[model samples]
Target: MSSHLLSRPLLLRHLPSLSFPLSNHRFRPRRLSSSAAVRPPATPEPAVSVAISADERYGKKQIISVTPQIYEYILSNVREPPILRELREETSSLRGSQMQVSPDQAQLLAMLVQILGARRCIEVGVYTGYSSLAVALVLPDSGILVACERDARCLEIAKKYYERAGVSHKVDVKHCLAVDALNSLIQKGEAGSYDYAFIDAEKRMYHEYFELLLKLVRIGGVIVVDNVLWHGNVSDPLVSDPRTISIRNFNKKLFEDKRINISMVPIGDGMTICRKVLQY
Candidate 1:
């Protein structure tokens, strides 16, 4: 990997932080085309008085809500490879299509891989292989990705896409629980060997996955956790569902963790990108 590609500044730029001030760098503002520019309504509508909800009054507005039109524009702007587009289209008809990562998220994952110049990676969930294919496509010919998934059917779909993308050799599919696969990797003395990892499996086991991944990934390696926001339910006091609670607790744990630096981004539900700062 080129030294410039793996520069600390480049890696830290993507991983937001408040603990340390980021080095000042000039960034060119994106210029939108005339059609893509946001315009106010042609006709001004009369303002109507509406009672503000408690949540609305006190809640912080950081990330913008992605409306359907906005999402369509994002999809049009993002560059999706032909094979990934085909896989995403095919996965949409499946039963758990919603579980798959969005195209923009996939693009982000691929960019992370390239930015880090990662050679070895891991994917805790492989739903229809959309994200995995994205990562595999960006990895070099010698790069390898250990993909763990229990669903045989989903794995089969992933395998088909991997073959079509001609990156089958780069993916090592493990048809077992994520915990077992992660443990197996540790037992084989692969601790702190991976360059990157992505977790999108069982919500309840997120903490466990983090602990294991911390050991498997070397110091400075990156771990990306998906669905951290749980459709905005994590902050809702009324929603005490098991899955929501699990994700909420996981987010808290990540916040308190000092071994890794984290940035929770509101993209594709939500994703927390962690960079290991200390070894386990």
Candidate 2:
């Protein structure tokens, strides 16, 4: 008999007649001495609760935070031409400078134009012409970019850059409300003629611009909508601002719309690339 079994007289009395061999470690009861230390049960770590609380406070994670170093690295790698760099730097000091697209976004737009072999393009909001210039630079010599902007001062700056870049012949500036300009084009039997369109105008009239542009761009043509995320405000339920609500509703409308195939890219505020798949 083991010493553990011998120490417990009450346990020994209830034992069956069949003896357990001393060498049978499986049946042996561990000796519990007075000096033996007892371990307390582990408490749950606080990290799990902290993470849950954070998720609740901030909503689900939607995008990776682009730090300054990362943005610098991205800019360093992009092939920003001299005239474009000058235009961007000059626009930085102007009011509403934030309206201009970032260098990386300009690169993406230029690449898209090249990929589409886009000859006829339309820009709804040409704020100082960074994006327009980028697209025009990639276009063939015969390509044309129709730019719409109501602000004369901004248009003048854009024209200066276009002239400097020697792409002035390729750009046709429309000094009128974008809707009026688009309507005029449709009136002239120019519907379904454009290869590409970019919308970055008034937030309230996005749907109008979209509807008008849908008629302007040809089948299989692409329309790139900027500020779709509205600085990550579209996903936040707490943000009930007019612009945010408008963008949220617009995003939902685009998702449910069957006429076009869409992809919402998370680059620079956010851009929704919609390719018209059905004419109806």
Candidate 3:
């Protein structure tokens, strides 16, 4: 464990931060030929509102709300692989489909996997396998993913999609509690073997999961915790729901911990990226 976990510097040398820049050219609509009949606009366009709400402006930075038009624009720009599209559509019809990660989040996860050069990963909650598929699709042929999901039905759906995506062999589905599975891995001397671990399981167990994952992952490995915002409930003072409270406290603990560096990006609910920087 010491030798494996202490290889942080060597791993860090292989990984670098990545960025993508958008095209600078402004979009322009093309005019139809005079020979073609001009079509009338079907709906009257609403005036663009300049007024921004308090929630729209966080501190000095302003962020646009995900309006229908904005969502359409985003969907039009991001390319979704056919297998991912099919799996997403199928998951949309299932009960509690909202639990599945958004396409943008899926894309981000894939990029993270590639940037990290990750081969071994762990998904704490595999809800129909959208995220699992996303990460697995980007991993190398010899890569492996340990997917933990207690729901057998959900695991079945995930397996079917994984097979269709041609990444079935890369994933090992574990139908058991996430804590149990993570602990079992540690007990079997698999600590510091995983390159990444994603936590989207029971909210109350997030802290517990983090503790276990911190010990299991190497110093350079990353652990991404989803829904850290708890649907905008974490920061609300009046909202005292158990889950919300749990997430709020967990976020505080994560912020104070020195073992990992954190960036709580406001994407798809909220994703807290914790990169291990110190050995346990």
Using Cα atoms with residue i matched to residue i, what is each candidate's TM-score against the true structure? 0.79, 0.77, 0.79
Error of 1 at 265 (Å): 0.7
Best by TM-score: 3
- In TM-score terms, candidate 1 sits at 0.79
Model 2, 1-280: lDDT tens per residue? 4455433211221112112222212222234556764443397322111112347677765543444324444445667777876787788788888788877788899999999999999999998999999999999999999999999999999999999999999999999999999999999999999999999999989999999999999999999999998867787799999999998999998999899999998777789999999885
Cα RMSD, each candidate? 11.6, 23.8, 12.0
Query: What is the Cα-based lDDT of residue 249 in candidate 2?
Result: 94
Residue-by-residue lDDT tens digits, candidate 3, 1-280: 1334222211111001111122332222234568764564598433222335466355444434443334435544555677776777687778788788876778889898999999999999998998999999999999999999999999999999999889999999999999999999999999998899999999999999999999889889999999988767787899998999999999999999999999997767789999999997
- Residue 80, candidate 3: alpha-carbon lDDT: 63
In what order do the candidates fall by TM-score, top score first? 3, 1, 2
lDDT of 3 at 219: 83
Q: What count of clashes does model 2 give?
A: 0
